[model samples]
Target: MNRPSILWKLYIAAFYVFLFAPLLVVAIFAFNASPFPSPPWKGFTLEWFIGNGSVFGKPGVLMDPIWLTTIGNSFKIALPVALLAVIIGTVNAWVLERAEFRGKTLLAMMMLWPLVIPGVVLGISILAFFSRTANGLEDVLNTDIDSLRPGLPLVILGQLSFILTIATLIIAARLRKFDRSLEEAALDLGASRTRVLRTVTLPFLQPALIGAGLVALLMSFENFNTTLMLVGSDPPLPITMYGQMREGATPAINAVSLMLMLGVGGIASIFALTSKAQQ
Candidate 1:
């Protein structure tokens, strides 16, 4: 057995520092009483965390109506995207992995093509495609395009376009390791195709399904470039944050960042524990 060299230990320590130092700074500054997020080390305060104005004689950073609404809107888009993307992705994974058909290669390539496209390009293309389609509908139906505004619905679709591919890949990788003999035996004995899928395949794929959905949820929540193009009037948290930052950053943004980190960290911790227990 050999110990790592002193240089290697220093290198690993430096890598972790580079990775987490910024996050640590952001977390620490969330409690800063200063108006701005940067240093000169203002005294610590809980004003940003609790939103308890009575205690501080002023409202916290999280009290803005638009910020609260943006948070809600993010959840709205992310939830549906996670569900729909997972469903479509699971079916696509199953079909691609278990079935035989013409154009299969083409379909698989199409599934992965979204990953190669830049988000900005994808957003612009989707906006153009939908705008043209909406125009055509307006001409045909002789109605206003108000109902067809690229709002949350369009945001969901845009996110789903790429997120579904992520789901498919995650599930597909898990599917590759699955033992088909259980499925074959179930089919041969008494189970129908749907039954086999429901009872055997889906159960076996549960971990992948959950992991993929969580990933989709996180991606949708944090999405900016594509959501910015298609979000219309209802901005998600990322879009709102970007707009705020362009003006100037405040401790409020740091507080928001801290909250997000805590929320995601909590979820990830739970997921890790659950997976470990299952194992």
Candidate 2:
């Protein structure tokens, strides 16, 4: 028994090491003095974040216009996607959970179809559908439908197509566990449906809503496969980083990776605090 327990602990330890050692290396090399993100330690420096006013011919991630633009574009797409997905997902969850209608199971399955599809395939399908529609509209009415072309709008739409499903699943799972008696009791005690929902139901769903929103935000930020298909002139961080890496990127990419890890950690901390407060 003791030997089995010791082996199980070692297995868990080894699994975590396998998962996180690369991230650990990336974090450490973010501050490496060398321009490349490779070996020999190269001491430590913060130039990858701030740079030395361009005298050293290295602009760093923050100093680089392309990197900044990609980062900005990532935020622009992610914020809206998260907001829209959460709102729409909450409504879908409520409807699915509280209401029963004909073909309800089919409707639910249809709603979740996007989750099973590959991200690249989903992106391609969306692109093709929009392209056909745009071409038809142009040929018929000769209008400038540039907005429908591959860009952030399309990226957001593609992300939302699947992310909405994930958000719905998260919220709906929580909703399933929710006791309807509270709402019913509140209604019986002269509270309106709106009041019951706002005061009682929403409070109970606070954790799920936060979790859904956070998942949506991070998914949008890190998404690459779908974003790659829909991206046009402007690229997101993942796409930009992939391009830079293909062309032999500098250690500044490490800095960006560390920044992302820190950002994720900070967001997770806020989520923990919010959940605790709600409890």
Write candidate 2's Cα lDDT for 1-279 as tens digits.
556787799999999999999999999998888867899987878889889536447778888887789899999999999999889999999889989899999989999899889999999999999899899999998996986899989999999999999999988988898999999999999999899999999989988888889889999999999999999888999999899889998888998999999998988887778656554
**Superposed model 1: Cα runs more than 4 Å off:** 1-8, 52-58, 145-148, 270-279
- Deviation of model 1 at 150, angstroms: 2.6
TM-score of predicted model 2? 0.92
The lDDT for every candidate, in the order shown, is 0.86, 0.89
Model 2's alpha-carbon lDDT is 0.89
The root-mean-square deviation over C-alpha atoms between each candidate and the true structure, in angstroms, is 2.5, 2.1
lDDT of 1 at 141: 90
lDDT of 1 by residue, 1-279 (tens): 388999999999999999999999989998988767778986988777666566544456578666688899999999999999889998899888988999999999999999999999998899889888889999999876753567998899999989999999988888988999999999999999999989998998888888888888889998888888898888999998998889887677788888899888876776677456435
